[model samples]
Target: MRTLNNHKLKLGILDQSALMPGDTPTDAFRRTIELAKLGERWGYSRFWVSEHHDTPRLAGSSPEVLLGALGAHTSRIRIGSAGVLLPHYSPFKIAENFRVLEALYPGRIDLGIGRAPGGMPIASQALRYGRTKPSDEQLPDVLRDLGGFLADSLEPGHRFEGVRAAPFVETKPDIWLLGSSSFSAERASELGAAFSFAHFINGDGGHEAVKGYFDSYRPGPLGSEPRANVCVIAICADTDEEAERLALPVELALLLLEQGQFQRPFPTYEEALAYPYTEWDRMRIQVNRSRMLVGGPVSIREQMLNFAGDYGVEELIVVTFGADPAARLRSYELLAQTFELA
Candidate 1:
């Protein structure tokens, strides 16, 4: 395993918004390209696209497709899914597609796997389409199968022995297991894969989950000690006031999600501030704010440095999707500046 030497903080971006309201897939693709370019220019080490289906606010439904598009545009920044819901796809197909991506991009591809359904129950059903009786256990099985496929093992002389992924690609992509819960920590540790905790979704101070991963870690082909990454929700602007205003969309989006408003694209920060919401909604937003950091570069930098120091994270990935594309890009730029890249 690589030793941690208090190296400079690593940065990455998570692009969740595809289009605001009326933007088509083409527009979203272009925006993705622009975001990737900005990420590379701003010193972001990687740019990960999330897998979301049937969500009007989210543009990345197929990470494999989006990754290909991103692969063509960016130069240095690595690209991959923040994760692909493994239970929804065949492990073989995933290995094949990502192998092709790895071959194309060489050293600049990441494979982050998540066990969640990645969509509403109805949408998930539609995605599976013909599959019946899909079990949660399928995720673990797929992860294991993927590891085998990537390791290029087929057992001795078995049928389909040493069958390489299509495109005849030969490269082992960096893999990470992503989750918002402890269930994933132990699983990733057991498999010796890098672990990424989604602090945005799972409340805060995931100390127990991180400890569980480290304590349970057993050296495997992929790693020796646990390689853990922390994912946080961050938004930075020139002023604290502007940052707070920009954060309104995220707060509203969370509130709406908690209240069963999934597919609706949230209003802008100014718009959200003007609209009327219930007291409960306001309270929920406040509670959610505790789990995120929203402010100017100085404040964001201080918070992130403190967070990284306290958590001992090897990598820090930020998910900064806003109601507007400009705000989203601005957030990335501000993060880069905070990291002294500007």
Candidate 2:
């Protein structure tokens, strides 16, 4: 059996600022900041926040804005978006946003962009409601424009060719393509951007998707070779039983979400325990369980490393959830301790 650590594997965190039970958005944001600060002190390599619009279940709608706060709290760890959904905004404008972030947190910024719409159809429509040209260009074109601006490699006579993203710093933010499929894998390789496979979203097919990325990578201005990571859901505790209990809420939450029954102010783990899941819900949880790694630190270590080995990647980005905020914080601490990350 492979120990799955021929070389040291780095770990990062993805915080969605999930709102639970009675917590306000302000409370959620504060917890997120606290997590970044603690994560840095615990030797985490990166701390990224996610974007979710018009969703009471998740308080973070703007990762770029949240990253600014994270930067203020942590001195060493890289802070970025788990990603910014680029489809709703302009490429040049998005470039400008990251440029400003890079200016503030210079060498510590990552521009992780995704092609997803980011929320429900109504919310997505609301976000782009006032756009004069909603379907101006495809995602690949927009990605190219953003990269061109970031690297100053715009082809001659291209639209917005000379329009620079200003306040440029000595080191620009690294661009990363976030997705869970081959489409993202190929595009990321073609553009020379770092790719982060969302194993938590799509557990299957990641091995092939990631293999395609590393096999067909074409180096560009962003990176000299392929750099890829996998993001997974984890809930670790002192005991396997405790970890499983802590993981209950997100399990139910995902099932409800997949079935179009998600509730606002997402249920806490304790509340979720009382939920009366039908047989179908139980079966769905069994399938969704494949996407999560829930156990004690030792068990979680093996599970995480297995996924890491499967994708042939060295870094794993973890997103943990629980009713107890303390357990959520401890989860990272335990993982770092088990891996001896320093």
Candidate 3:
């Protein structure tokens, strides 16, 4: 991997608002707030919540709503959606929601939008509420409207010429396009928006995707220079063995999820350990492990720094998964110290 001696790497967090078995959604919300506060104190650059629907394991179905509470609880760290599922909602409404957040916490909100459905068809249909499913071809138009609304720059002859995402704050939330492939990278570049690659979801082809974004990038509202970040699953501990132990739950969760077993509140480590596994299951775990960064602090730091350098990105957004909330927090704490984030 390439090395950048002068680059100052940045660290951010992506919370899924994971629900432990027997934990209520209310408890999950409180935990997210607590984690945000702790992350701020620990020197994380940003605290982002993800959107998921019809999944009991993830309580953060409405990242915009959670972002409001996170902004209220944390004084400094930037708060945002890991992303909002753009296809299900109106671009106008999405702009207004983040605009309200920016109005409340100017210069500290990020609006990360994605084209994914974020859930099963049933839940997705409910979100659309009888509306037609948005096609991939519509993303460019959706992004155009979203940007226009945020910047108050809708061109003449546009359908919503007079419409505005009101409360028109001077500082709009920073906008980012989130995706697991080059499609979003190209779109973000075309729109001149910041791009975040979801490496945790799809680790393959990331190099080409990042390169595409950088090559096609143009100056826009966020800044004159190109900006991008890689989001990945990272779990760190004092020792490699312990870190691996802590990561078992998520590994098993992903494996089962791939097998079409959507168990909510994720299985505990003991449960995962107790379950019988065949050779194929073990192989599948190894395959899924390719997308994660798991190890002790020193190892994780070295790997993540190399990952950032290789991708030519200075920022890394980490998502930690485990049944124990304390273990999750500890993982971030270790990473914060390892990266010397502030």
Candidate 4:
């Protein structure tokens, strides 16, 4: 793998559009647009939103719709799905959806695709609506079809030959494969697409998965050189203590999620501070800490850079979660200044 000590790293933001108690979906969307605008001003490279289904705490179920809104509201920043769950939808439809966004926004669009169900099994079943589903092993074929539609390069004699995702615009959205495992890395490499390893979701596999991507990469339409990034949970505050305090709500929320308490919104810091915790809860938090980077500006900057170096990637996508929108916004601001973005 190639690593450069003096590489100028870029930063991107991933918004889950978390809906806390008393917050409506409308409020969540407004905040998403507001954050995208701020992210552009802060010089972040791209602003991506995630898709979640049947989750009351996450308001973003349709990233394509939100990407249209984001593109409309922000003039400079690149907007995309962090990504769209490919398994639940048709490849041609996904290509068409993003193609429309690309036609509307031209050069400022992206289409990050992933194989995850993006929700519980019941929700996944609902997404399929009783249709016979493709096996998990067929994800590669799905990706290939999606790429074919996007690139206008379906192979001769293919089943979907000549079925192009229209309006046939000159500019196509950049496509990336999102994953947290070696399977995704290998698939991305085999397909010659940009890869984003989800370190925030699975921290332990990143270094090895990234290495595997580099080793197996082949030149294709995305680019000859391997393009990859590591996505991680990050929070920054003026002081280390304050940063830890700010992280408490997300920590507790994740613990609850692990304990099968779905649909619960993030709690306030005060609530998290006062909540009684079991020894198991404390242990879960400690174990999950490895996946996050939480500290003051100095420490956060240092750790982010270290992660970039370790992963051999020059770009890092930061995903922040909090009950307070202001805290989440401030965390990105601090990171932007710390890295001197733009």
Candidate 5:
């Protein structure tokens, strides 16, 4: 296992393709593409995008489709899904989609799979076309099947054992189990797939979850060695106050999510900052903010390293997807500069 060093800590980006009031989905995607290019030039290790189906606030609906575009735009940085909602699609289809990407980019793709619907209940229904079974219940079996498809190692006599995910290439995308809970960590450990805990989504129990993963890791079809990272929401500015200011909108966004308004458009910077925070809202922000690393470059770098060290991982996929676009870009630039990634 590799020990994390602050000076050598690797950072990656997780973009949700969020949109403000005036921006169209196209504008958001273009920004995501440009962000990947900048991330590569800035020496970030991996650039991953998230999927949110038919959400007005976010544009990225299909990471595999988006990754194809991202793979063409950048050369050195690894491009990936943060991930794709695996339950809505077939493992064989996903295997073939990423196989096509691997054929194109050859060693620079990652396929992060999540069990969550990644959208509203109605949207999930539409996506499923009336499939009744719950995805969470079936995710483990799906993951195992996907591992076999990716490795061409389906057990003899099993259905689809000899079938190939077409356009097979020498390289394969890194398979990752992405989740915010111990269930995913345990599964990833059992299957030997890469694990990325969504710390931004669920802040508690992460250290325990990740520790369990490393301690109980076993070699499997997807990977022999344990690979892990934590995704964190961070906001960096020139000062602590500015960072807090930029975090307001995101805090409000999460608050809305908590209130069952998961897919509404993000509030504007002015709206969030100026909105009156009730006692409950303030308390929620306090809880949400505790998981975030928001400060200037120096403080952010220290907090990020401490986070990675606690999780026992060397890399942190940093998500600075604040409400401000220019500020978001500056956050990465400052982080790359502060960490000397470039």
Candidate 6:
């Protein structure tokens, strides 16, 4: 296994600020931008948003748009998707959007790719209309096509042969592979892309997957050495009780997802506090708590440092979820204090 080094832990924010129900896309975008601006002051290295279409709760369906907006507001913090689901969009289009952003931002953009559709079956179908659904078997080809577009490689006789992105961007946006399973680790390693492990997606068994990704990872085009980041659920507070209370928003969402009941992120912390759940919801909540890291600063730091020691993570992206935008922002502040991001 790899060991942690002295590279001042690269802290980042993974914003899904809309899950606080009734949160509008505009609100989510603004909140994320605010966080990015704050992160710049705190010395954070990056701020990543995700892409989820047709989801009432998630307003980050268009990550590129949000990233562009953030780039305009903040000068230093890195911005990108926790991942853009590659299976649903054309590689050329994805490259084009990112190319434009890179042109505007210079050295401040990243592009993380994931294989999941990131939404319901129907939503995925609608997004990929007329295009073949990508299977794990086809992931390599999809990645290759996207990679080719970025490198501006047009093989002879290919439909996009000799097609160069206009405006001639200066940056090759840093690309990261985001995944909840080991499947993507191999691909990231093979392609020399940085790998981001989603602990929030896989829950308690996340470290095993992270370890697997690093164990099998070999240097590729993104870097000669393997680079990996761990993304996890984190909500910090002055007191453990307060943190737990604030975590209710995410717990409510987990309960809903567990019961196959999906809704938009709530609008307020009080709104989530009123949600009704069954005994089964209680059971699932108990199970999911093991996957979350919520507590006071001391407790938060201890848990995270221990997890980092046990797993060789090169970067840590903290994700704060809740109904009230203020509460969500507080969670990030608390986490920043704990991680010394501030």
Work out the TM-score per prediction.
Answer: 0.91, 0.94, 0.96, 0.96, 0.96, 0.90
After TM-score superposition, the amount by which residue 318's alpha carbon in candidate 6 deviates from its true location, in angstroms, is: 0.9
Model 5 Cα lDDT, one tens digit per residue, 73-110: 89889999988788788889999999999899988988
Model 1: per-residue Cα lDDT over 1-342, one tens digit each: 233332377888877746777887778878888888888888887888889887776678889888988888887788988898877777779888888898889889889998787778888788777776346565555566787777676456645567766666566788889888887887788878888889888766476788788888886644456788888889899998989888888888777788788777666767787779888877888889866888898888877777766666757888875767877788888888778652
The regions of model 6 sitting more than 4 angstroms off are: 1-7, 19-23, 154-159, 221-223, 264-279
Decide which is better by lDDT, 1 or 5.
Answer: 5
Report the error of model 2 at residue 98, Å: 0.7
Cα RMSD for candidates in order: 2.9, 2.0, 1.5, 1.7, 1.7, 2.5
> Which stretch of 10 consecutive residues in model 5 shows the poorest summed lDDT?
131-140
Q: What's the lDDT for residue 210 in model 5?
A: 93
Q: Write the per-residue lDDT of candidate 3 for residues 1-342, one digit (tens) a residue.
A: 457542388889999888888899999999999989989998888989999899877888999999989999988999999899998999899988988999999999999988888888899999999988678898788888888899998889999998989788888888889999999999889888899999999888898999899999987644356789999999999999999998898888888888877655588999989979899999988988978999998888888888888899888999998888888889999988887775
TM-score of 5: 0.96
lDDT of 3: 0.88
lDDT-wise, the better of 1 and 3 is 3
Which candidate has the top score in TM-score? 3
Clashing pairs in 2: none
* lDDT of residue 284 for candidate 1: 85
Q: List candidate 1 stretches off by more than 4 Å.
A: 1-7, 132-138, 155-162, 221-225
Q: Taking the tens digit of each residue's C-alpha lDDT, what string does model 6 give over 121-151?
A: 9998899887887788888777767766776
Better of 2 and 3 by TM-score: 3
Stretches of model 3 off by over 4 angstroms after superposition: 5-7, 220-224
In model 6, state the lDDT of residue 199.
82
How high a TM-score does candidate 1 get?
Answer: 0.91
